[model samples]
Target: MKAMRFTPPGYGGRRRDPDEVKRDGWRKQGLLAVSLDDQRLTWPERELVRQLGERLYGARLDKTEDKR
Candidate 1:
């Protein structure tokens, strides 16, 4: 197994191999994980996700918010 090492005091965040900056500095922001249940989502959008999930897999047996 690999061992974990502490980052140096002045370490910067992750960088791309080419490191070419995109418009509005998206490259510097790196990757981010957005959740479907985020409060920013509208009601219609959440409904769409629920419907799509049901069609792709099957109807959710329970009525909880954990649709996915």
Candidate 2:
């Protein structure tokens, strides 16, 4: 039997390279943007999208429509 070790998000076993992180982040952002643009989600889905975008971008998602 082998023991497994756990690590945090940004620092884990077999650490990811800087370039890999940047590339993957960019890809995820692209997909998220496309999904938002499609405007096919219900309220909860939209909230999830916004939360994830805020997390990945380190800023709040625009709330222009929320004011309505």
Candidate 3:
């Protein structure tokens, strides 16, 4: 597993990289990545990742509502 940096929301007043966010979303769907540090993640964010991983392995994600 690659050790990707997990940037917390609103860190240092710096905006997150959109590309990085997209990459992380892809990685979560594959379940091939893990957070480098849990302490930096909020509870809901962690849960969202967990659910995404489960959905990725268990069922097809619904794309009907996703405009991207």
Candidate 4:
């Protein structure tokens, strides 16, 4: 499986590769393990993520404050 990348919404930064993030969820808590290739999100879920990203990480808002 290729490296996993996670760029959580509302976080001001570039996408974070899986290697960069810790897998504490499995080490600390016995939560279900998610494989890089096994992780799949539904279309709706994906759309929601896109929308949230646009709202949060969208281009600087104040830059276009004037409606001229």
TM-score of each: 0.38, 0.34, 0.33, 0.34
Residue pairs with backbone atoms closer than 3 Å in model 1 (clashes): none
TM-score of 4: 0.34
Instruction: Determine the C-alpha RMSD for candidate 2 after optimal superposition of all C-alphas.
Output: 12.3
Error of 2 at 17 (Å): 34
Candidate RMSDs in order: 9.8, 12.3, 16.5, 15.2
Candidate 3: clashing pairs of residues: none
Worst 10-residue lDDT window, candidate 4: 30-39
Q: What's the distance in Å from true for residue 51, model 4?
A: 0.2
Best-fitting candidate, scored by TM-score: 1
Worst 10 residues of 3 by lDDT: 30-39
- List model 3 lDDT by residue over 1-68, tens digit each: 88758767676566668657767878787524545246668888887877886877664347675543
Over 1-68, each residue of candidate 1 has an lDDT whose tens digit, in order, gives 87658777547677644324432255456643333486777988878777777797687667756654
* C-alpha lDDT (0 to 100) for residue 61 of candidate 3: 46
C-alpha-based local distance difference test score of model 4: 0.57
Ranking by TM-score: 1, 2, 4, 3
By descending lDDT, how would the candidates be arranged? 3, 2, 1, 4
